[model samples]
Target: MEKSLIKPFIAKRVAQEFTDGMVVNLGIGLPVLCTSFLPEGIHVTVHSELGIVGQGPAPDEANADPMHIVDAGGSPSSIVAGGAFTDSAESFGLIRGGHVDAVVLGGLEVDQEGGLANWIIPGKRMPGMGGAMDLLVGAKKVIVAMEHTAKGNPKILKKCRLPYTAINCVNMIVTEMGVMDVTPEGIVLREYNPEFTVEQIQAATEAELIISPDLKPMA
Candidate 1:
């Protein structure tokens, strides 16, 4: 697929949340795309589960190396000139120790209360939880990026039917339609695309979304 078809806008927004020298972990799939959107001048440090730290931006097409395997996307990447290796044990230790500043991951469903259900599919019985359970508790901040709806059905629900990996773990969610923050009051609408409305988002979501008074169109 062409990169044009990808909604890096949300990725871009999530990347903006990053700061210089912060350690970030990118989950599989869409979250992996966030690396390509990072501003060139920033020296953000990236980490991968495959035991890599001091990771760099996504490589150019001609530069991409599938063997590198920084993230699931197989984007071109670079590591520290002399990096060390650790087993999943040590890798997870970094995650569980709260060393990760933020995590960007995809989601199957997110409830208004910030409950995240990214694994399993009810009667279907899909793959169970992966690192999400640990990341939820480990990462300082969690940003989820996913489509507002999946195959015309709302992924945001009042209650997750498939199964839940974590309850009230997400800090923010950026969908194709809008951006929402899990506030003390509720899921606050932080931003929305130009073509959508609060009612439109509400209609497409099974969960109750609290529209922020400052809700503005996406810039």
Candidate 2:
């Protein structure tokens, strides 16, 4: 698949993990795209650390209320009916208090043991670790959604090279190349992109993968 199509493909697959009435939080960038691909008839109440709950979709740029409604990334967004805006403290309380069902976060690297390192790269200036640390531990399920590789370098590895945001916190990983479950034995390849062979996928990942007997094509 073309590079341009990868993010959305990964997002669509991640969206499949959400069920109706789930309260999900999406990290900035790629993770936020999952909102655009949720399965039909599913009603997920999206949360934004920026203090919005029941978050809706991005609005038409021409009609967007930029100053009043925006996601954590500062992109214009809409709020669903009955959605309420809260103070930052209360918003974070919802996360730290474990009120969230799941959180989809973008990652720089994920390891076989489900370690996640996404907050920063060594010596690179970063604002700080945002809500990731809290969400990873507080949410019921944690999903890492990212590209399979970065400039042809595997982002999935035997062990994460960067500082971890949380250890053994990830439940699943969704990338354009496949869907993997981080399990006790290893990273299990539960679904794969039909365009690539198992060897090809393995070559793109530094972590050893255990192919599932029930492995199926990633749609």
Candidate 3:
């Protein structure tokens, strides 16, 4: 697939995991794109750590509210009808209180033990580990949505080198190359992109993968 098509492909696959009436939190970056690919007839209440609930998609510049409503990433966003806004305290309360069903997060690295490292790279100036720790442990499910590699370096590793955001917290992973579930046995390959064979996908991953008996094409 063309490089330009990868993110959306991963996003579409992540969106498929959501079901009706689920309250989901979308972390900054790639995870936010899942909103654009949600399947029809499935409605999910999107939560932003910035305090917006029932958040909608990015709006056309001309249609955007002059008040500057934005998501947790600070991107201008729209709120669906019946959506309500709350203070950040209340938002964190909801998350820490386990009101969220699932959270989709972007990762820099994920290891065999379901560890994630995304907040920062050592010595690289970063804002902070915004709400990731809370969501990782608070949400019912944690899904990491990211690319298979970074500049040709594998992001899925035998053990994450960077600082972990949460240990043993990830449940599923969706990348342009494949879909995997982090299991006690190991990383299990569930669906793979037909563009790459099983061997090719394994070559791009540093962690060992257990091929699922029901493995099929990603799309």
How many steric overlaps does candidate 1 have? 1
**Per-residue lDDT tens digits of candidate 1, residues 1-219?**
123554676687777778877888888777767777777777566777656676655667777676754553445566665455566788889988998899888888888777888878866867667677888778899898888898879998877776778887889988878888987677888788877778889899887888888989876
What lDDT is reached at residue 95 by model 1?
A: 87
Best of the candidates, lDDT? 2
Better of 1 and 2 by lDDT: 2
As for candidate 2, its clashing pairs are none
lDDT of 2 by residue, 146-173 (tens): 9999999999999999999999999999
- Cα error, candidate 2, residue 97 (Å): 2.1
- TM-score, structure 1 vs. true: 0.84
| Runs off by more than 4 Å, candidate 1 | 1-6, 56-78, 122-125
Off by more than 4 A, model 3: 61-68
Report the number of clashing residue pairs per model.
1, 0, 0
lDDT score at residue 198, model 2, on the 0-100 scale: 94
After superposition, which runs of candidate 2 have C-alpha atoms over 4 Å from their true positions? 60-67
lDDT of 3 by residue, 1-219 (tens): 688888888889999999999999998778888878889999899998888889988889997874769877677888899998989899989998999999999999999999999887888857688899899988999999988999999999999999888999999999989999999999999999999999999999999999999999987
Ranking by TM-score: 3, 2, 1
Error in Å for residue 211 of model 3:
1.0
